[model samples]
Structures are given as C-alpha cells and as structure tokens.
Target: MTLPSAYTEAPARRFNVGERVRVKLAFPPGHRRTPVYVRGKSGVVERVCGAFANPEELAYGFDGNPKRVLYRVRFRQRELWSDYAGSESDHLELEIYEHWLEAA
Candidate 1:
C-alpha cells in the first residue's frame, strides 16, 4: 500500500544523470549522512533517487522540513583509492544528499 508523504512536493534537484559532481568535504559537529572517505571525491550522477526528509535534522528531533534531493552517484574505484587494484571499469555507487555535493 502507498502511504501519503508529509512533504507536498519534492525539492528542486541540482544535478542530472551523467553530470560530474564533487562531494563536499566539510565536517560539522553533529549527525551527518555523508561519509568521510567520499568527501572531495568526484563522481557522476547515476540517477535521481528522489527527495526525502533531512535526516541530520530529524536525528536532533526537528521536523526535517525542506526535503533534500538524493542521488545515486557513481565513482571510479581507482579514483577513491590510489592503490586500488581493480579493473578500470570498477566503480562505487553511493546515495548522497544534495547538500553534500557540489559542482566538479
């Protein structure tokens, strides 16, 4: 069964499939969704995963208003790890929020 969402509409997306983007490297003292290893790494947007409540705020008991766009990004394994010894086509996919990404 489909459940009604609290948000009336999805937030505007800042990226599209195949667009190159970089993860923001900022580290704030609070709950975060973005991982440390992926910070500052460049990747391509594989697909749009739609917008959802901001978990960081939700974790702190806020209403989680202003939904954020989430994306599935594709990063080459070699680019993430300098000593990676996988095939050239090897890559990693991560679900990153819009606030954690920037133009590459």
Candidate 2:
C-alpha cells in the first residue's frame, strides 16, 4: 500500500538519535504495534525510521493519516529482563512508533 499523495511532507518528528526515552506502559484495547515486553522500559533512540501510517489504525481498516514518526530504539537486554544472564553490552533494538514512547 502507498501513502496518499497529499502526504508529501513528513510529519513533525519527536525524539532524536541518542535521546533517552521510555516506552509507554499503556494497555489500551484494540490493535497495537508496541510490544508488551518493552512497555515501561527505558532505551535510547538508535535512529529515526521515518514516519508511516499507524499500523494499529490500519489493522482496523481506518486510513492512518497524519503519519506517526517511527524510531529504532536500543535497550539493554538486562533492562528488559531481570533474569537476563547475557553480557552487559547486549542490546536489543525495536522499531517503535512515537506514540508508544515518552521522555525518559
């Protein structure tokens, strides 16, 4: 699928590379793109993945307008799991939509 031609300009972006952020802990009903594992976890913004139509909205057959900025966030493996036994440098990156993130 393609974005509407009217969406030529990119939407305003939020977080920036290397900025600390926290995933929202919300458990709103209906389709969601944010993973449960990352909820309320802190991470650094690895990079901006550009804006796209909200997948959660699209799943409901609604036009995802006013694109949401997408970001690749990096989280230490240990932060996501209290029982993690991996190296301290281990990290996981997830492409999360801006709506699911908040200032850390």
Candidate 3:
C-alpha cells in the first residue's frame, strides 16, 4: 500500500503575529495529527515556533528538506470547537505550520 504525498518538502514563508488566517486540515486514512476537532477552522497567528522537518517524508524513507516557518496559531474557542463552553472572548492556541493556513 502507498500513500499520496499531499505536502512538499519546501520551506514556507512566515506570517506575522496577529495575522488572520484559516487552517486546512490534511487527514489520510491510516494516520493524522490535525485533529477532527479543528478541521477547516479559522484562527489568528500567535507565535512563530520555527522550522520543522517533514515527518511524513522521513517515514516514507525520504530525507526531504526541512520546513522552516512559524507555529502556535491562536483561534477563538467558538471558531474551532463548536460546543465550546468558555466565554466568547476565549480563544484556543494550535501549533500550526505555514501550509495549513490561507487568507480568511
């Protein structure tokens, strides 16, 4: 069995803090990290966590290029978890990569 390569090894550009963006979840049949709780959710750029090598590439026996970018995206609890119990002002933080975001 083989899995499709949905992501590339290219490093992505960094986004500014407080930038508004959306998260695009990439889930395959057998394994995934992006939880079902936050698929296609919108959020704000929080902190930049730096570079991360492609885990999928490593698993596929390919030493792909390291992906350099930011992480820790903050989203409103109401925006992600639909049944969020916290106040409207409350937000959630996610360690997202550059590829997961798009203009919202």
Higher-ranked by lDDT: 2 or 3: 2
Predicted model with the maximum TM-score: 2
TM-score: model 3 vs. ground truth: 0.71
Candidate 2, residue 3: the lDDT equals 23
Off by over 4 Å in 1: 1-11
**Local error of candidate 3 at 99, Å?**
1.4
- Global lDDT of each candidate: 0.86, 0.86, 0.66
Error of 2 at 4 (Å): 28
**Candidate 2 wrongly placed segments (more than 4 Å):** 1-11
lDDT of 1 by residue, 1-104 (tens): 11343433334788977899999988888999898989999999877778889999999999887888988889999989999998999999999999999999
Off by over 4 Å in 3: 1-14, 25-31
Task: Give per-residue CA lDDT, model 3, range 1-104, as digits (tens).
Answer: 11333433334565766778887765666334456777788877666666676555566676745654646678788887778888999877777757667877
Candidate with more favorable, higher TM-score: 1 or 2? 2
